[model samples]
Target: MKVKELMTKKVLVLKPNNTFEEAAKLFIENGIDGAPVVDKDGKLISIITKTDLMKAILNKWKMNERIETLGPKKVTTINGEMNLEDVLKYKVSRLPIIDKNNKIIGIITQTDLINNLVEKITKKYRDLKNTKLSLMELDSVIECSYDGIYITDGEGNTIKVNNAYERITGLKKEAVLGRNMRELELEGFISQSATLLVLKNGETTTIQQEFNTGVKVLVSSNPIFDKSGKIIMVVTNVRDVTQLYELKEQLQRNKEITRKYVSEIEEMRTQLLNTSEIVAEDHRTIEIIQLANRIAKVDTTILMLGETGAGKDQIAKHIHKVSKRSKKQFIKVNCGAIPTSLIESEFFGYEKGAFTGANKEGKIGLFELASGGTIFLDEVGELPMDMQVKLLRVLQEMEVVRIGGTKSIKIDVRVLAATNRDLEEMIKKKQFREDLYYRLNVVPLYIPPLRERKQDIFPLINFFLTQLNKKYNFNKVFASDALNCLYEYNWPGNVRELKNIVERVVIMSEDDKIKRLDLPKNIIGSNGMVVTLNTFEEGINLKETLDSIEGKLIKKAYDKYGNVRAAAKSLGIDPSTFVRKRQKYINNIDAQYKT
Candidate 1:
């Protein structure tokens, strides 16, 4: 080590112009006996001490006089780059340290070197003491161990055996110690020897051995190597595992029983889902429902994707009802319904008096209210960009910080988000964050539109009709022709539209039976196979009636073919004309149904 490493870098340097009183005050305040003196150009001149100051005081010298007049001009100094051993050769208690330019950089005292020497000596002593104790404890630990410990020489001669070995093998140390393992095995004292195997292979070995006394033991032998890579000794650990084998067989039986119980529980859950409000007669819908049920057992985020009124909300609620958190609260929030300016406060809540017109007791955010439960974010795609960042943080950290509050509240909430908008496309357009999209889309569930799952239409219609009849205290039924039209019509609005139509016909029909004529005009025009003069008996315009019929036929072809070119060809028209007529009809439909 060098002197610079041990020296104190912050050194007090006195100047020739400083008064004796000033030098004395610095020495007293800093708890130092001496300091280096420098000239005006900061060159080391000498060193001064309290003894020199006291001698000057005894001589009745003025306290305001310069300190340079009292201290000796000659002083000892050392270079910072010099070895630390050179410091010991000096007679002085304190030495001023200088750089290559002979300028004082630091100061070193004899006590610093002494203290460093003492620290090194103390550490070495502590290490030796710990090593000695460890070796003593190792021997005691081996002797007191529950498992048998047997040691043999490289030549397979028994060297030592702990009390546990004697007790487990039913052999005393006097009978086994110093005996060759081959002789013991040939004499019928043991069935086999793990130590002999280790000596032959020069590696660790294990085997099960049976003693003549009918005691069974499992032994593992590990070889100890010398510096020349030759085995010096083999240490064997013996354990009694006869009871362990029996316990393993019992454990296998228990696992089989547990599996049977799990299968029964799963069957019960499946039955519960079938009895719920979700109608899953179609194969694709049934598969989706099964997947939702399986994932509901855990706390994973699920994103429901489908067209508007496709029962996305119903699926989200179903997930919550079947989840582990079913007993807890299920809070639903429409991201699009909340105002953008107040979204942050509404999501993370706020402290009392956070802003103007705030509630006096503050408010709990949706996340906090749904802690230990579930939160369904409907229309999640409509969240603002800024709120998306905050939501991502909450999901990642599982905690939320309220507005105007410093403390972060921990929450255990499972998130289920549903959106009619395409979030992946929104990510490409820079409207949604890619990372947030991945978090919410851990499990993507797509609910098919009503047109795709026609098998479910009749069941859902009957369900709605029954519900409406019960509410109105009247019995209502749909005619066969009406049910056929509903099944054939391409429902653009999905389940929500079907429910509304069912309720409308049930209440407005003049008789108990709802016939095909009682259905909506749009539905009849779209699905009716034959147009009769009786259909116009209610007094319709000639031009409007003809235009409506033509538009419905074009739409029907487009729905069947699913492409502009093929749909137009089927109707004996050009693709361009098909596009034009489709756009016009869509506009007219929107205008006519604006209520």
Candidate 2:
């Protein structure tokens, strides 16, 4: 090793003007033997030690002269930049390292050289021990790991290898070593790759490839250099990443196993989302469910357009749970919920004191936190016009400029935007930028309102009842009459409302079996009142009103049963009535009633 390589980069020094009293204190505190002395310009001239000081003190005692004059003659000075051999050949015991600007950077003593020798020998011993351990790996283990461990010469000649290396080359290590890598060359350059790409390019690279032996490996190579800085060897380590990769593949396989699996072990969480309880029988609802599966497969931006409280967040999470980004964070932000004044910071981030009451240590926003993943922006159309400009800049630039920060930080994130507001109307009013809308609407996904998917209602209700059973530790079943009442009412709050209503009925019902009386009072009165009014207003008969009421109740049952078919079965009404009602009044129904 070169002397510079062995030497410490950080050194100690003393100013020439400092008296021995001051220098002695530093030496004692640092536990070093000596310090290099420099002039006002910090130029290295000489080094002083306890021995040198003693020599000066003895000389003064002998000649009765000032010791300052004796200091120059008694000290030995060697150039610090010179190799160790030069100093030893000159018979010097000390070195004074000086910069081009003449600052004294270090002092090297004979004692320091002896200490460095001990350190070098110890390091060499450890390295040799490690090599011995590597050679003895076979004796210590039953089988080798999938990773290929190999060594190559300066000219790229194979020297040593393990079982993994033999497996990767389709040849035994004994048959390959002492041979050039040409003997192990593959037919395809891009396919069966090597860990030596870094060695070939004179830089390190971690890459994935299929080996010639038909195994996939993730490989890394580190270059080894000789004293002259020439490339002498390369040590490559590879791990078989096939099993790990397959697990990832398994997780991303968003297929026909399409039943929603929302966790509801907690109380508040149970009331919030209950997709499985929604029974949907309409063919359009099935189409949307299939579409949800398709959306989960793509990484492109998804724009969700629908009325509020229609299970948009649930759909967004469903998409995330089935996508490639499922393992990463699924950050949610309501553009409308953020104050206009703090919108930029909420989305991009901000520096310390970026504004009044700003976080002191700086905070990473959803965009940064969502990097390497996805962010579901709820009600994206509600973003203020000014923030829209900033968001558009980020989407276009693929970077974010934090509030009060000059530098822009790039991020890799898939955005999912959901909104109840009609973006087209907002665009018409110039409240939302059309350019931004187009950028976000890369893959448009429409989550039909609950009224449209009324078939999904009953299944949802049943699912919620089971969920409530688990929560309150009570068994509760819906009676035919109660189920009928639920089916008849208009759902203004959509699936969210239905789930809460189911949970409320399960918990509040005095009897084990739910009946019409246990149904929410407003729903009971409103369904009958509307039917009575229509019967009188349209000069319709009681039979017509009963048929109409049955249609409405069947649609609600469809929503509760998680589809229309099951609800029709429960109501003893034809399934087509649920389908017709959903298509017939979906647009006019209040969104709040459905949720």
Candidate 3:
């Protein structure tokens, strides 16, 4: 209960300028121990108590003496928002309820607090007496209580229990009626009985009890004394706290998640204070983001095809973040990093002792762990043929059977697979399954390489600079020439490489401004063109040279224009013809770099 609920609102106030004689008369007539002394505007200045009035009379002070002169200049006052129980902790006889403007609104004296407590106790006594008088109607009255009520005889044997008791303890009266509390405790049905405690103490006691049915409850037991002061009955009130415990656990989890979200928001706020928004001026990039937004509502499998460091992973994370399963786990699996020997067990999990050195307890697989959420398979093209077959079955059946375990567990995981490698080409070589390729390509989102979206370079640099500057606690800005040089680079490694280069320059350079000279040697010499002439050869292979030159031109146009169709338009080449040449160029590079 709050102070406002108990405090007397019709209070007589004493002005600071009021005479002590006048204050004494008001206190006598109102029967209030104290009154708050306020200024002309009614703001509390100090309190004038009956004790102060008595002291003034004893000292033989003048009747015309100001009340403010008798009391301390400053007073401790409580706000209306304070809890009554907290206010009672202080030793003050009277407490003034002050408002936000510091004006006295109400007053609570010792008499008010005592009266409230007495009223409650009297009501409870009257109800109990009435209940005892009507023995036939006792059951109906007890059953009306929201809290579970149980009654035990002097011998600590169950006599009566309300409907709420059965629901709370999950124990029916037929099972507990006439049963001894000690016997039930020994049988492990209840952790401990409040009735047994009250019978021994012959007084009121409160105890926490956990039942065998997994219900936790707080039981308050009161012993009823007879004419000889002997315990005649033990009345216990039970309050189930199972849902309370669950709510507490959930609150703890929410607090942890809130902490993480707060940290992220702080970091984002710092970035926002330092830099502009993520740059995506390129039309293709805009279209891709829009498509991703549209596709976030669906639960279809998505295959994100892009070059390494082209923001494919970021796109996948965004999709899952905005999807319905955002609250669930988003597990990322690097298919290429897992060993061929353990791929099956890693994806499908294994039972205990399924293999040597396996965990004693069985482990859940990534798919199972990501149930009702999403599973991102990174570098999925690297999965071996054997594992590919198993993964295909999981995708088709939506279930996984643990190794050495016969039961097939159903899974409801949304698959989001990403790979820089060309799965269609791998399929042609019989390295990737054709069926798996189709299954994962239900919604393909291709992220263009960073080099192709050169407009985004400056913003990305600013973003990285803001992040790195905050990290290293340095003030750094990029020179125009340096930014131009970054724009000129072919960025084979895409945005990831740009971020690394920015960090390297920031850490290595001593100057506040990053100049072109601070850039790496390779970037300085690239001159916005692909390297063509082979140093190892004396004469250029004309066919190889022409193909290399054409590839570079196509890459440059594609970088500037964003897609094959646009690149073809800018180059004055047929869209179909440009695609064919682009494929040939890629095939040549693959052949040259193949292991």
Candidate 4:
């Protein structure tokens, strides 16, 4: 319980300027031994008590002297949010309750706590007296309970055994009622007694017991304490566990079946991704795919941030395919495609006859349609500021009211949004809502551009090539030089541009083999840059010269890209390889300086 619950709300507060006589009069009239002292602005200054006034009298202070003059200025106060038990730790008779602003709001006194505790104990005793009308009724109540009840005296002598106990233990009440628990255990009638354990420990105890009939039961014994803190009786509750053990075995079988199903489902999701043309050869891309798969199991808003054509939509689809809502609809909405005037109605739907050219029947909104499923909002950054507010509310409440409908339709849709714009900058520009941005960016997944994850480009080229081949029923292949040029050219449009280019070359080129000359002029021009070779010196070691040249190119790429992975992609090497080579050059330079 909180301190505020027990604290006296209407507390008599004295002012610091109040004289000792006035303070004494207020205390006597209110029947309070102490009162909080505050300034004119209601801020706590100190506490004045009857003791302080007595001290004032002993010091021969005049009655007109201020009460604050006699008491100590430092006072201990408890926050209203503190627990009631916190009051017990302080030795002070009265504690002032203050809010966060340090202004007195209430007061808790020792008498108030004692009175409250006494009232609770009195109520408990009254309830116990009312329940104990006759021994027959008590026996009936215990017999009606599904669990077995066994009562024993503090000395561990069984006093009573209900019908349920006989049924559970297969022992007659007459056989155990007058028997001692230790004697029963010694005679091998029962394995152990919870009553004996509780009496020995002076506390509640629970254990699994077995009877000579080979029946297992869970037993819990609670000790009843008297006024002097002496244990008077122990009540043991018994539950048959033979069926529970069987049920536990069945549950284990069910868990095994569940594991098999989960493994099969994961395999199916992998196959789904393979068919969906997702190439995850790049370490970065593979990491993103793994993260997406992990987060798909949970229902959380995900924001896919990437450049245009970076396969954000594909990742969103992959997440849906692996999610628990895989069997349900995966609705995709292009926020940028919808017209501004019709955006709200298109997203939220509208009631019949609510607007001009409205559908005759009331339409279900995208959120409602995707209920128990997933919704993909592509180009989410393009949504208007006003629409962002509505979207944020729908996400927050998980419900939406149609454009012209008064009732809110509850939804259980998982939101997956993708954007190619800088939402943080947009928020600063007031083009987007900051709250909406944070709601959508709960789990942000950034897909690296094609240039940054160049290793995946070749696999994606093959994937799209094979797909287009099967679709068009044509046999086409790219020559080694053409492939090299394609790999060398930077794809600003990311995966989408790569797929389009592959399709274009496969369809446009007449030859069976796509040669370097058949490639796009831009691709060739971008890859045609030449390197300048320095004049060869007589003492130049061929390997050392080549190493120096490689080091310079690596350093240049690293400096320009400012990212290890991207720089490695530019150098056509792995990130680990880049790091190793960079360290190697540094070590060589240090060794040269040492020499």
The collision pairs in model 3 are none
lDDT of each: 0.72, 0.62, 0.71, 0.72
Q: Write the per-residue lDDT of candidate 1 for residues 333-438, one digit (tens) a residue.
A: 8775566678899899999998898898999899999999999998798787899999999999999998888999999999999987778777998888999999
Q: Write the per-residue lDDT of candidate 4 for residues 372-415, one digit (tens) a residue.
A: 99999997976877899999899999988997789998899999
Best of the two (2, 4) by TM-score: 4
So what's the TM-score on candidate 4? 0.44
Candidate No. with top TM-score: 1
Q: List the candidates ranked by TM-score, beginning with the highest.
A: 1, 4, 3, 2
Query: After aligning candidate 2 to the native by TM-score, how far in Å is the CA of 375 from where it should be?
Result: 0.3
TM-score of model number 2: 0.43
In candidate 4, residue 397 scores what lDDT?
Answer: 95
- Taking the candidates one at a time, how many backbone clashes does each contain? 0, 59, 0, 0
**Tens-place lDDT digits, model 2, residues 207-308:** 776655666777777666655665566667767777888888776664323323323223323332334433445556556656766777877888998765
- List the candidate 1 regions with Cα displacement exceeding 4 Å: 1-275, 526-595
The C-alpha local distance difference test score for the whole of candidate 1 amounts to: 0.72
Error of 1 at 244 (Å): 56
